[model samples]
Structures are given as C-alpha cells and as structure tokens.
Target: MTHPARLFLDRAPSPIGELLLVTDETGLLRAVDFHDFESRLRRLLRLHYGDLALETGEAPRSTKVAFARYFAGEVNALSALAWDTGGTPFQRAVWRALTAIPPGQTVTYSELARRVERPAAIRAVGAANGANPLSLVAPCHRVIGMDGALTGYAGGIERKRWLLAHEGVVQAKPMPLAT
Candidate 1:
C-alpha cells in the first residue's frame, strides 16, 4: 500500500492572508490555515493519512506549474494530475460532478445532489462538498445554499467569498487576486 507522506508546502500571499498549501505524495491536499500548519497538518495526518510520518518540503513541480497556470486564470480545467481525494464512492461521484461545473458559474447544493440522482440527499451532497480535498481545483466553492447564500466552506467563508468573487459569480467591491 502507498504510505502517507508529506510532499511539499508553499505559502502564497492572497488578499485574505498567506495561505499554506500542502500536498501529499499523490496531489494537492488543501490550502491550510496560515499559522497552524504544523498542528493542522498533524491532525490531518492522523485523521486522513493515519499515523504516517510527514516531511515538510517544496510542492512538486507539476503541481506548482498547474497552480501557477490556474492562478493566472489562463487555465480552468484540471483533469490532469493524480489526486488522492479520500472519500466514499458516492462522495467521489459527487466530486467528479463538481469538476464538470465550469468556472464563473455556480450550482446550488440541491441541484448538485439532484444531478447525482440523489434528490433527497441534499445534506449528503453538502457533506461530500465539505469533504472535497482539492478545494478550488475541484471547484467545490461553486456550490451554494438553496437560498443562494454562501453556506459553508472548509477553508473559511472569506476564502469562499474570494473564490466566488474571483469567478465573477457575486460581484464584490474589488476582484480577488487570482489563485
């Protein structure tokens, strides 16, 4: 079995603050909290990767390159690169559907659930959305509450606002820095 190990880390300064990006041996893990890298990484290691050891380093060239393109708004599609999104079969299915949601567009959680043939599984769909690991790459931020209000985001609501604003969904005062 492939053991869990830290691949690399990079700090990207954004409008909100400096985001700590982490990746595993597979692909981009998540943008972690700015100052809580060690603690959050440790918790993630235990919860997601079990007791596997972690080593801090630079992000892989491929991922770094992809992120660069993404941040530049020159690329929006991310079918390339291997991702280890730890989720159940149903959740994976939901996340795959999320990727189909084009940039600069938004989808309600209920709509996403219905598209998955899980009309009554709205809450489940939200759970799967909250569990999305690739975050912006997977485009989970595009999902909103039924009332069209920002519901929940693992990376915090401010980041969600930035993502939606970046996509031109809900117009904010000033555009967020890409990526």
Candidate 2:
C-alpha cells in the first residue's frame, strides 16, 4: 500500500530573510523565502503533496534547533538530513561532488566536472546543478561561475548573493574573467 503524502511547514528567521521550511514523509523538500517569493512554491506543493493535507506549524521536532545552529555559524557542516533525489546517474555524481564543497569554499562548474573525471562535461555539470532538489542542504549555492561571477541559483540570484555573503564571500571584489 502506498503511504499518504503529508507536508509540514514552519517559519524561521534566516540571515537572508524569513524562510518557510517544508518537509514531507520523504524528506525536507523546500526552504523558501516568505516575502516576494514566487508562486513556484505552490506548484511545488501541488507536485509533492498531490492533494494530501499540508499541516502547518507541525515541523519535524528538532528542525528549529538545526536552523538556529546553521544561522549562527556554529554548524559548519550538515548531517542527519533526509534528501530525496531523482536525477540521472551523472546528475547524482555532480550532486555528490557538490556536497564535498566545504563551507566558505566554492567551486566552478568546470572544476567540478574535472573532479568527476569528466572535464568535458562542464555543461552537463551545470545542468545537474540546476536539477538538484535539496537546495541549500545540498550546498549547490557554493558553485560559482568560472569567471567568479555569481551564476544561477534555483532559489534566485539575490538569495545566492546573500548565501555567498553570509559565508564570508566579499562581493565588492572585482570578479576575474573566466580563463
């Protein structure tokens, strides 16, 4: 028998702004900003919940604790997370490489592809980065453009800048041209 789909939401103040966290039986599916957030969130909800009841104010027991630690810079790494990924094998490989990027450090798409021994798959690596489902937990935001410019982030460019800034990346420095 298939288990019912259920979603729970909780609000937590984050460095970037107020974020709405959503979780399901599968895992933590989304963490989104509350203000000026796009309607894509509802679409995501429909796709995941599929008519299942979305019960708010019932976040997983200790999620707030984790968020507090993460925001305070006390949690340099993440563990015990339940991530649900459905992507191609190559995409999974790219996601795995992304997780290896430590806090406060960054990597370029081409660099990541090279690490996977697929230097020719830079474009493919970018595609996989775009397809990552776990967002911040997967640390996709740490991937930057080869030219040192802030590239695309599923969460939006502003949020990406905020994440980098929060991690001590100096935005005022001039970006280097891609070599």
Candidate 3:
C-alpha cells in the first residue's frame, strides 16, 4: 500500500537561519530543516515518502507560534507539538528516544543507543540521528560526541553550536576584545 502524497511548505526565519517547515494536509509537521539544507530535506522526503507532492503555504498557526516561542527561548515551546515522519521501525524508535532528551542537555550516541535499549547499536543510533527529518523539533542537535565534542548535524556544526549555546548546553564563544 502507498501513503498519501500531500505536503505543505513554509519558510520561517530564525536566529540561526531560515527554516523550512514541511507539514501534511492535516497539519502534522513532517520536517523542519534549514534553508541551505533544502536538498537534504528533499532527499529525505523522497527516500521515505516516494513521490509526495509539495505546495507552498503557511505553516499551521500553532506550529508558527511554537517556533516563535522556541526561538524566543522558551526551550520547551516545541516539546508538545505534534509531528509525524516516515522511517523504519528502528529509526522510529530512535526518534522517539530523542524526544526524551531535555533541552539544554545532551547525550552521546552510545548513550542514545542505550536509551533505545540497543546498547550495541551505537552506530545505528548515529545513523538514525543522521536520518532525522524533524531537526529541532526532534532535538537531534542535542546528541553530541562521547568526548563532548560537537558532532555532525544536518544543519551544520556552526548552527549546532548556536543551538547548543542557545539552549544553555554550551557556553557561547567569547567575543573578541576591542584592539
């Protein structure tokens, strides 16, 4: 059986960059990706949804408000927002586990694997994290390297740093002193 093929798209401006919010006809969020990462978003949707149709439109009012509140530093503004995405069972499990990570906190890939009850699937956890289509809403940016290093983010490491600093998980870099 084939899934429905209807997606709504919206461009929302944020401190980090413009974000593309994709939703279904019923207003369930499907993806939240950076503008520069549009190609990746397309690839992800294509990989999962297969020939879905996209239309430019305003995001749902609640979604817009949640994003506004989130960017305003509420941190948990999006925690309760409803979202749906396509993925395998393992990926779904990993994505569900990701939502349990509180804002301003981070976990290593290995720890995420343990949280998903697949402690031996650290690499699999990382792969699932990499495949996350919801971006900030799923909080994949909260996953870091075991050594406390900022690792790969579909939104780019600099944006990851900004998000971590925004969430108080990491201190922002000090500005240069006047010469």
Question: Any runs in candidate 3 off by more than 4 Å, and if so which?
Answer: 171-179
Give residue 6's error in model 1 in angstroms. 5.8
RMSDs, each prediction?
5.3, 4.4, 4.1
Backbone collisions counted per model: 0, 0, 0
lDDT of 3 by residue, 115-165 (tens): 999999999999999999999998999998877877888898888888888
Q: What is the lDDT of residue 22 in candidate 1?
A: 68
When 2 and 3 are scored with TM-score, the better candidate is 3
- TM-score, every prediction: 0.76, 0.72, 0.92
Indicate whether candidate 1 or candidate 2 has the larger lDDT.
Answer: 2
Report the C-alpha lDDT of model 1 over 1-179, residue by residue, as the tens digit.
24445555665554455556667656655434444334654565466666655566666677656655665664473446556645577987898898889877888898999889999999999988876656666788788776677777777677778777766786323323459
Number of the predicted model whose TM-score against the real structure is largest: 3
Scored against the true structure, residue 178 in model 2 reaches a CA lDDT of 70
Preferred candidate (TM-score higher): 1 or 2:
1
- Candidate 1, residue 173: the lDDT equals 30
